[model samples]
Target: MDGNATIGHGPDRHPAAWNPARTREEKEEQGRRKEERSPMPPVTIMELLEKCKEKTALCDAREAAHRIKNDGDLVLIDVREPGEFEENPVPGAVNIPRGFLEFKICETCPEDHAPILLHCRTGGRAVLAAKTLAEMGYRNVAAYQGTVDELLAALE
Candidate 1:
């Protein structure tokens, strides 16, 4: 036997395995299986923000305060530290730091779908808090991406 010769039968012995028709069908089947197993596409921040805008789900601290003053059911959540909240908050805002927001939001706002307006020193922590709330099944949540100084100035 030559060095390159087939070991057992012959080089073309597995004819069915190399058939183009079978290969195509196998590939299509694999693609179908993959499609079936693919997870739902993750929601993007822009989409979430857009939804917030559509539902009137987001507001700045001043807007939230005005709404609260005008018999709105919006819950103003300060996702910063207690010291920061004490330093300055939108009049009636509750101090629920970002770390404990997921656990405490339900207790503070019993309704699973209640509208929540969240704010921090800047927008970063508030966005994280809003995302956490959204993940926890809170349908109406928004982040105020402005600093305390900006909020105070706006209020004035």
Candidate 2:
């Protein structure tokens, strides 16, 4: 259809028609309807990173290892594959690989609100995992950046 032509089927609809006699209340109502239909702004990667940092729950691999060794309260979740975890993992870390994390963590963990420290081969997968966990209402979650090897070296 042409830009100036009305497309919808109704007596009240007119594409090129503008009601100059609309009252202030009517204008306000139309503005409200338009605002309600507008899409929300997209969240960027930088925003996510900053949020993770501000939450105070995010930690590096070395810090996570220390927490697991001393605090013993946080859940150490290795988001790497089973094969990778079998080769080596941080001491006392549970193997809930990235693919199965959503299912396994929610099922097995006793407390939905418990603090969890997640790590993958590197930081990338852990960030994604942490985001997922946070979205699922796990308030206290952290992502460990370093891989198993780096963690082990730091421990030594």
Would you list the C-alpha lDDT of every candidate in the order shown? 0.74, 0.77
In model 1, the runs with Cα more than 4 Å from the true position are 1-68
Clashes of each: 0, 0
Q: What lDDT tens digits, residue by residue, belong to model 2 across residues 44-91?
A: 887776666565456765687687778757787888888888888677
Task: For candidate 2, give the lDDT of residue 100.
Answer: 89
Per residue, candidate 1 scores C-alpha lDDT tens digits across 1-156 of 444433236554553336678889999999999888989666787776555545434567677556556647878788999988887776768999888887788789988778787888877777777877777788878777668787777656
Residue range with the least summed lDDT across 10 consecutive positions in model 2: 14-23
TM-score of each: 0.58, 0.62
Cα misplacement distance, residue 137 of candidate 1 (Å):
0.6
In angstroms, give how far residue 15 of model 1 lies from its true place.
49
